[model samples]
Target: MASNDPDREEEAAAAGEDEDTGAQVAPIVTLSEVAVTTGEEEEDALLDLKAKLYRFDKEGNQWKERGTGSVKLLKHRETGKVRLLMRQVKTLKICANHLVLPSVKIQEHAGNDKSCVWHASDFADGELKEEMFCIRFGSVENCKKFMETVEGIAESSEKNEEKESKDASDAAGLLDKLSVHESKTEKAPEEVPAAAVKADDETEK
Candidate 1:
């Protein structure tokens, strides 16, 4: 009976170990990696700063808050085009998106040193619309930096456009000259002599 008791105790210990098993189970679903793309992939970020933006609602007759997020100036790598983009902080939703054109005006908002106002043809809503926007920065320096960078990009864009126009005009003029020279140098088709034509006609008759 004493030997049987020891064997029973050993059996209970083995069952306790099996009940508290530490095994890892495999997951039922396997996930594959997917590539994510943002439209700004082809563009290089020039400036990134945190700011709060507002837009004037003509219908409401008051200023409406657009978003508080990181505003960016993105320049295209190939085309040298610059655009201003701002997204909401929490939701990461775009609030403002427009090109930095020379014709658009950016000025200090009222007497605020940390804020600036600008007019743009915004496309954040997936359509172009004229919008008046004012952005306030946490510091005066950031406000100035954003304004200066925008102005510089605008001037550069204008110059690039002018240079492209001049280059296209020069190319067109060169093509026209080539066409005229070709016309002048081309030989006229050979005409049969009157005597030869008359002899052929007489032989046919």
Candidate 2:
């Protein structure tokens, strides 16, 4: 058993050597993962679907592809307001951001069953601009769903606006009545008291 090869034994000993020196190397710079906010925190997504978005270029007179990603209809929890949001697929960059106002109109794009068009005052690019937008879905059902959801939100927003207007009008009317009553009350003091009038007559007698 002692008749072993020296080279083999040396190689085995080398292989058995612990390569870790037990000294840890510290990183030159440490980076901690920071949380990113998408500004959608206070909203709840009502509808989310995979879709492609487009914008009509007035100068070119043709629709331009915006992005392909998930489009969402987000409703605020407290305000009950809804907005349409679409971000680029990989980048997660917002391509469309606009509120679903009462004036919004979404219709099926001409000759496209799986697509719908709408107009919105978009603020995604940091400036408010009146934009004509079109969105296409993989299925006709998704397209219909997007359109229906948007239009329903618009209708609800319109009703809320109308109700707010009526309430404001009623408040104004009540305030006007109170103001008129105050004016009458102020002028009522100008009329002489009956007892004062009688005392003046007696003094004159």
Candidate 3:
């Protein structure tokens, strides 16, 4: 016995309620968004880039900041929004007077055209370390000078080491030969037989 009009009104009210709630609802995209929505697909291409080696010498005890590498920036395609690209920063403590210097060589896989090196030194007591670090990047020509310098130093050091080793070996051999000669010369002269001396004396008599 319910009236058709009342049933119609109830349905209309339900539709209005749904519309009100829908207008207030806001859609949000969280960080868990899928890669497709992040719009950073192009950035992924650069992710495989090999890190470059940057070298510098630090005094036995000092703190220094190293700035050697590309500064990444994210540019939004549509609005030209630029976001600073985040990178990893590493800090090491100087522990030796003559640091063997760790390998800061950029992997061959890295682009030579895009690579660059930065060198810095910090000294204790607020004095800058007299030592310098050389950073190399870009074209082969860019690194040519530094490479040549390193080669020269290495060659010089190698020559010195070789000369020292040869000198030591030569000195050792001379000492050995001298020792053998002395052993032979140290033998006492053969003693004359008493019988031979008596024979000589008899002959004289």
Q: What TM-score would candidate 3 get against the native?
A: 0.33
Q: Highest TM-score: which candidate? A: 2
Model 2 TM-score on a 0 to 1 scale: 0.82
Q: Which has the greatest lDDT?
A: 1
lDDT per residue as tens, model 2, 1-205: 6648999988878887956678889999999999988899999999999999999999999989999999999999998899999999999988999999999999999999999998889998999999999988999998888888888999999999999999999999999999999988775446777999999999999
Q: What is the lDDT of candidate 3?
A: 0.44
> Model 3 over residues 1-205: C-alpha lDDT tens digits?
7667988989988998777544465568556655444334443221111123333435445434434343232344553332222223343222111211222122222355433442223242245454433333455654554444434434554566687799999999999999999998897989999999999999999
Q: How would the candidate models be sorted by lDDT, starting from the highest? A: 1, 2, 3
TM-score of each: 0.81, 0.82, 0.33
Instruction: Single out the weakest 10-residue window by summed lDDT for candidate 3.
Output: 95-104
Q: Which model, 2 or 3, shows the larger lDDT?
A: 2
Model 2 error, position 138 (Å): 0.6
**Root-mean-square deviation per candidate:** 7.2, 5.1, 21.4
Candidate 1 clash pair list: none
